[model samples]
Target chain A: MKRIRMIALVAAGTVVASALSACSGGSEDGGKDGSDGPVTVSVMEFQQSRIDAVAKLIPGFEADMKKQGKDIKVKLVADPLTDDQFKTKVTQQLIAKQAPDLIDIGDSLVPGWAGAGYLAPLDDYLKGWDGWDHYYPHIKKAMVRQDGKIYALVHDTGVQNLFYRKDQLTQFGIDTAQPATWDDLISRLEQIKQKTGGTPIVIPAGTAWGGSTWTEGFQPILGGTDKNYYSLETGKWDLKSPGFRAVFDLYHTMYSKGLLPVQDLENPNPWEPTKYVKFPEGKIQVSAQGTSGWKFDWGPQGKAPIKGLNEKVDTWQYPGLRSGDAPFGWSGLGFGYGIPASSPNKDAAMLLAQYLSTGKPLADQLVSSGAASPRDDLADVKPYADEPKLLQAGKDLATSVYVPTGDGAEQVAQAVAAATELIINGKADGAQAYDAFLKNATDLLGPTLVKE
Target chain B: MTTIAATASAAAGPTGQASPKRRRRRTWPVVLLLLGPAALLIVVFILAPAVYGAYLSLTNTQLTGFAARDPQFVGVDNYTYLLSNSEFLASLGRTGEFVLYSAIIGQTVLGMTAAVLLARPWVRGKGLVGAAILMPMVVPEVVASLAWASVLSNNSAGTLNRLTGLFGADATDWLQVVPLASVVVVNIWRGIAFAMIMFQAALEDVPGELIEAARMDGATALQIFRFVTLPLIRGPVFLYLLLTTISTIGAFGLVYFLTQGGPGGRTTISAIYIYERALQFSQIGIGSAASMILLALVLVLGLVYVRLAKVEV
Candidate 1:
């Protein structure tokens, strides 16, 4: 009887230990070096095409490894989660100490994620990397964290272009050249609306488009004002600034005058009809969109392919609020890979990130997805040489303003989205929306954080 | 297993009768030994996490940034934040609306109606009707949501829009125009089968004679149902109400996958709000505080159901 009881206690202890070990998922291997053996480095990827893009690049990394007599296999973890879910998944995995070796995240997310110690600082790796200085100056600036340490690599950079149907502009007899000011852009849009009898310009808005409502819609206009939400000097979100009101007023002006697509912004996926269907079918003649739309939305392989894209479509640099003010929009950033500090194989992970960032692999992303290279010598790249529009957008990256990224950035973006949503619904004009933005910003970040 | 009889017997070597104190002593260790593994599992898996969550609610912990690295204790601050959060408060109200419309009114009524119809001996195509009613229960939540997303999506090509077009009704963005109602309806669609199954088992045990006796007393059909059938199935009804209400309040995946609390926060129920705060927005402290509030609400409701209805379980 005593023997049996002892055995039962031993058995129960074993079960509990086993259960906990199973839950651990080898978290003790946080710094385990798998260099001597066959090592698999998992990467978190959210899109199939982008995953396929990485799949194409993995062979190069592994073959290069094989040349050095090391074995490394890449595993792509497919996540088709929503944007918020994508953040949540990575955050949870990082907290649980089960993160994949590499995280493919937006350039904006790099600061916050790295600040939490979820990502490894790449500054040590950059010291020996030959390709560190090859990226464009802006891309290089974006790679360094506010703490003056490198956190990520810029994969490929692109800018938001103020694109219009050249043929439609010709028919309307409106100037096809870059709009010199907000008034010029609005007048051109009004002219297009008068001729076409439909909404001519679309800047994405509302919560349905998620972060894009702020990033692509509101912040672009705010960028034209030459003031940003986060002030680096004081380190406070600028709520009472005129730049805040200016962006809202611009939204109110366009929306109240029926120049914007208010109805489509309420759709389940706001960008679908506006970017894919209406734009390609010539229902809307002018819009600001990422340069990736060249391959992802209007090229031959695009969902709604526009015929004669090169000749038919033309783009202008984003113009300022007033005439002769320098052009600015929320552009000049790139999405890329980062290594989790908890990763067992940091060396292999950085190798994969570097391999994906430079040379033929980087050029292929441009041809395949129109993810223009962040390299300073992008003009010499074969893919950029073949595409003039991409070349122009690449050159324009020199002047674009990348959104400052850090801890409170996401909350600030949410505030802008809320403000724009009010304007989109016609619930508030510029002043009222700015009031709403201020209130929401204070609510999100607390009273002490938000300032004039 | 039985008080470790060998030890007890060895100790009882001289005495013919075991002392009451020794017997009491032996029984407790045996009882504790019996309950040990189960209690250990509960502490490790359930209670510990729940207590930790309660502790988390009082802190300034977040999913990222400075707060994540060094969470500071801020007693009741998280609770105050959640209470003042307009979005969080509105989400609670929306959850109440969902519970009332989707579970209390919609599922119960529709499920009872189907069960009553199927209970009738003269009902035709009973198997077909039963199968159709139960089909949704077998469909995965995501697959059902995907199908409904396509059906209720905007554009003329949507299934429901195509159907309504035949009547000259203009295509409407169903999810946006009536966001709450759309989610309530989808939730109702998914939840009806559970209520139906519960009611069917319940209605089967309702003695036919009592219902017949009520009818024989010149009671109308409605009166017979009100006095006879309802009272007989009261236990299961109360049980189902308790389960359905709690489950609906806690529901996230079905409605989340379908709408994600969108189209101007119309469908932002408590679950979605909790998820948004904790994970998406990375306000773990506030999320945990809100979760405690939700837990309290569920507890109060559960107690009310049991005490008011005089429920057995």
Candidate 2:
């Protein structure tokens, strides 16, 4: 009886100790990551569709670390919620100081995140990295935050184009050549409407459509305005200028005249019905879309491929606001990875992140999700060199600007989206929407941050 | 003598097998042993989070920006902002409409109808009928919403569209046109089975003589149902409404899946508004404040129901 009592007491004590220890979160040296143990670098990829392709980079990363005499293991963490929920999930984790080691963050989000001190500046790390010089100056410029510190590596970039169906243009007796000006573009839309009796153009609008409204729809047109939304020199958002008015005016024309499918823009998944379905079916003839329209959306491996989409779809550069001006395009937001300040193994994680940005892994991203590498040297690399169209697009980067997606840019995008939404819903016109947007932007960014 | 003793014993305590002092002494151990785990769970899981939420509501906690790093305590600002915020106010009205349409009228009425019809002796294949009625409850909310999304799709070849086409009408995207009503319809389909089961159980307990006497006294079926059947099942109906009202107010998945509170915020009910502010925009303080306000409203409404039902929480 005494022996049995002693055993029971020992068992109970063990159980209690176990429960108490379990309640304690974790320790760095408890076989997770320590000086002696293999460093476990947690890498998060927000896009579920691209998770597998991203995970394939782990083995290569670990092997590279081994050659450097570093023991490392890469663990891939996917966004628990939908891809749309990345901002929320990442923000929550960062604020709680439980962030994953390396994060594939959107370029627009870099300023806010880095400013908030969630991200550790990559300037020191990049200075040590020999491969940093290969990135184009335009691409490198996008990586700099408001603090003039490089916060991330720009892995991939894309440019938007005015995609029009060739068959529709032929049937409508429209010109096969690119429109020279905003008026010319509007006239073509009018002709398509008159000839086909369908909504002829849809530049993505509405809040649900998110940043696409600003980037794909309005950013390219900013080249025509001869003004930028944010001036690095003045350090002020140019809300008071006629630049925004000219851009919104075009949207007003598109929406007020029923040129675009406003209803489809207001839905949850904004791009699907209009860009993917109607555009492919030749119901809606013209749209402003990223290179993904051919590379992913209607590629052979796309969710809904249009037969001979590359052959059928014709492209036009976005025209200037005036009748006599140069057309423009951009290497859009440098979608790349940043090391979080709370990351356990920042050095190991940074190494993995930088590795994933170059060569075959970056090449696969284009095929997986239409991400074009900003590194100019990738043209000589086999996988990237093989994809001639992607290579050509990368080579064409010298002609375009890096779309400015710096401090307070996402809010600026939201303000633009909200104003565009009002226009699309017929609640406000161009001038009224601009005023509303300016007021909203001023309110959000503070009067000191914005200038009229 | 035996009856008096039994009455005395009953008046002593619950089991009435022990002396009053002894029973009182034993109750402490019983309470600790039986209810301690449940009490601990409730405190840890529910109460702690609720208290934390209340505290968070008073701060300027954000998910990003400088505020996310070290949140500042700004007392009552979020609540004041909520009072003046047009979007949040608009969502309250939308939520009210959703609850009334989906819960009070749609689920309760339709479910009672099913229960009444199925409870009749002449009704055939009661097992199949019960299963059919319960199938919606068996289907997960996400699955149901996805199926409905496909059914209410914009495609001309969609299920609902094809059915409408059969009737010589053109196909229409019902979700786009009637966003609120479309969600209400799906919510009704999802929740009706719960109401049916509750009402069916109540109907089983209802005395048959009262319903029969009304019918025998030259009363119509409708009159008998209204005067006799309804009064008998009033408790069950009240219980169903109380539960369904709260559930409908908190409905998120169905509406989120179908519309995501879109098409110019047409279907953005209060829950969606909270989610948008808290998670989407990363405005934690405002969302928490909104959540607290919603909680208070629910609590008050629950108290009102308790006053009417004269029951415990």
Q: Write the per-residue lDDT of candidate 1 for residues A1-452, one digit (tens) a residue.
A: 45545766776787688778778775322233554557777877776557677777788888998998877877878776656668888888988888889888877677678878888888888878888778777777766666677777778678886778898889779899877788888988888888888999888787777777766777777766756567555556767766787778888999988998887776757777888888888888887888877876788876568999888888887778854577664574657788998888898888888887777777777766676778875577676568776777777777777656566766777777777777887789989988988887787776545664
TM-score of chain A of 1: 0.91
Measured by DockQ, the strongest candidate is 1
The parts of candidate 1 lying over 4 Å away from their true place are A1-18, A26-35, A322-324, A447-452, B1-45
Question: How well is each residue in A365-395 modelled by candidate 2, as lDDT tens digits?
Answer: 7657665668877776766667655665676
What value does the lDDT take at residue B253 in candidate 1? 90
B1-313: candidate 2 lDDT, tens digit per residue? 4643554565566866788685455344434444555665677668988999999999977666655668889899889888887778999999999999999999999999999999989999999988998999999989999999999987787899999998898888898899999999999998999999999999999888987888789899999888888887777787788899898888898999899898888899999989987887667788999999998988887777777776555
Write model 1 residue lDDT over B91-201, tens digit each, in one string: 999999999999999999999989988999999999999999899889999999999999997889999999999999999889888989998999899889999999999
Total clashing pairs for each candidate: 0, 0
The candidate that wins on TM-score is: 1
Predicted candidate 2, C-alpha RMSD: 4.6
How far in Å is the alpha carbon of A195 misplaced in model 2? 2.0
